[model samples]
Target chain A: DTAVSQTPKYLVTQMGNDKSIKCEQNLGHDTMYWYKQDSKKFLKIMFSYNNKELIINETVPNRFSPKSPDKAHLNLHINSLELGDSAVYFCASSQRSAAEAFFGQGTRLTVV
Target chain B: QQPVQSPQAVILREGEDAVINCSSSKALYSVHWYRQKHGEAPVFLMILLKGGEQKGHEKISASFNEKKQQSSLYLTASQLSYSGTYFCGTVRQAGTALIFGKGTTLSVSS
Candidate 1:
């Protein structure tokens, strides 16, 4: 079984459209995170949830919201997407906040 | 704060050795190493917690200097499979999110 998994490996949408990416971890980890990798390959943390509680929220735009319905599931929703939103979004989980993280295959988002 | 990585990129041949360094200005409680191949997720390499401990692998090793808040990843006997971008994630405390470095690109060819 995949330790971490994300749906919609590839997504292409028009500008102003809203979309969502779902993430799940079967490792029974307590902490989950969402990271965005730009074209330059710079990985930036967007949000993090610990035990279904919000713990870290970077300077991300309001259009991006993260929902953690349960400890094993975290989902990202983007509203009115822009061209800048085109990037690879990754979902990761760790046993604890500071432990090594396992990342999902990634969801490639393209805004045209 | 984000950690600074040295040698933005490196090219090495099989059997050659390379070293990638990661340093932070603030005090760190632990350092995590990961390697990401093109179009793939980042894979964990190792983790070095406080106490300035050193961990070794069959061909890769890493050292941590808590006082200086620095860590170095040593790759010996480089293999083509080692070609990827190496990232170092640092945590200031146990419950904080891991902050990653810009990453160092490594290319190992036979």
Candidate 2:
């Protein structure tokens, strides 16, 4: 079984459209994160939830909202996607107080 | 804040060795190393905590220097499978999110 999994491995949407990506982890971890990797491969943390509570939220736009229904799931919803929104999004999970994290395969989002 | 990685790219022949360094401007509580291949997720390689600590897994090893706020990943006996982009993540404090570096690309060829 995959430890961390996200739906819609590939997504292509038109500008001004709204889309969502779902993520789930069975590692029984306390923390789950969303990271965005650009074409240059620079990984940046977007949001993080610990035990279903928002912990760290970077300087992302309000159009991006993260909802964690439970400890095992973290979903990202983007509103009015822009051309610059095209990038690969990754879901990651890690145990509390641990330094290492496990990442999902990634969801490639392309906005026209 | 993102950590800085030296030698943005490197190429080595099989059996050769290479070292990738990561430095942080802020004090770091821990440093983690991960490798990602094309079209694949980043795989955890190792983590180092505390000053003067060294850890290794397989032929890959890493060292942490708290004083300089730096970490170095040593890839010994390079293999073709080792060709990938290596990233260093820094933890400023416990229970915080990881801040990753720009990444160092390593290509090992025969």
Candidate 3:
């Protein structure tokens, strides 16, 4: 079974369109995170949720919002997406915030 | 803060050795290593805690130096499967998420 799974492995939309990517983990972990990998392959953390509570919110733009309905799911909603938002988004889960994490396949978002 | 990685890229022949270094500006509580292929998710290699411990995985090993705030990943007898981008993630303190480095690209060719 896939430990961490995110829906919509590929997303292509207009520049101003809004989209959402859903993430779920069956690892029974307490912490989950969202990371963005740019063209340069630099992985940057965007948000962190622990036990359905917002923990780490990086310097991401306001258009990006993360919601955790329960401990097992964390979803990312992007509003007014721009061309610069084109990147690979990955969802991960860990027993603790600092422990080893398991990552999803990644969602490739291309904003035209 | 983001950790700095040295030798942005490395190319080695089969059975060769390579070293990838990661340094942090702040005090690091633990360091994590991961490897990612061309178009795949990053796989966890190992994690080193503050006590400056050394961990090994197959032909790959890593060392942590808390005082220097640095970690080194050593690849020995490199194989074709070892060709991938290696990333080092660091945690400054407890209850914090990992902050990854710029990453080091390693290419192993016959």
Candidate 4:
């Protein structure tokens, strides 16, 4: 079974559009995180949820929001997507006791 | 904060040794190392926690210097398959999010 999976491996939409990316993990993890990898290959954490509680919220714009429906799923929704938002979005999960994270294949969202 | 990685790119021959370093401005509780191939997601290498920290799964070795706010990954007897982009992630405290470096690209030639 897949440890972690993300929907719409590739997404393309125009600016000002709204889009959502869904993620689910088979592993019984208590924490889930959202990371953005820029074109330069630099990765940064956007938001983190542990046991459905917000733990970390970086300097991400208000246009981006993350929601955890349950411990196994975390979804990211972007309002009025901008060109700068075009990057690979990765959803990761890990146990509260473990420092290592298991990442999804990644969703490449291209704002055209 | 973002960790800084030195030697943006490196070329090494098989059986040789190479070192990848990661430094943070803030004190760290642990450091995580991972390698990513050209088009694949990163694979975990090892984790170094605080002082007296050193871990390795294979010929790859890593050390964390809490006081110095730095960590280094050493690959001894490098193999051809050891070629990939190495990244260092720093965790300032327990349950904190990881801040990654720009990544160091290593190319091991035959």
DockQ winner among the candidates?
3
**DockQ values for all predictions?**
0.84, 0.76, 0.87, 0.60
TM-score winner, 2 or 3: 3
Q: Which TM-score value belongs to model 1?
A: 0.99
**Can you give the lDDT of residue A95 in candidate 4?**
86
What's the residue-level lDDT of A18 in candidate 4?
Answer: 96
Considering lDDT, which of the candidate structures 2 and 4 is the better prediction for this target?
A: 2
C-alpha lDDT of residue B77 in model 4 = 96
lDDT of 1 by residue, A1-112 (tens): 9999999999999999999999999999999999999998889999989999999899999999999888999999999999999999999999997788999999999999
Q: Candidate 4 chain A: worst 10 consecutive residues by lDDT? A: A94-103
Please give the distance, in angstroms, between residue B19's alpha carbon in candidate 3 and its true position after superposition.
0.5
Cα lDDT of candidate 2 equals 0.93
Per model, the share of native interface contacts recovered reads 0.73, 0.71, 0.84, 0.43
In candidate 2, what are the lDDT values of residues B32-99, reduced to their tens digit? 99999999999999989867699999999999999999999999999999999999999888888888
User: How well is each residue in A6-89 modelled by candidate 3, as lDDT tens digits?
Assistant: 999999999999999999999999999999999999999999888898888999999999988899999999999999999999
lDDT of 3 by residue, B1-110 (tens): 99999989999999999999999999999999999999999999999999999999999999999999999999999999999999999989888888899999999999
The candidates, ranked best first by TM-score, are 3, 1, 2, 4
Which pairs clash in the backbone of model 4?
none
Candidate 3 off by > 4 Å: none
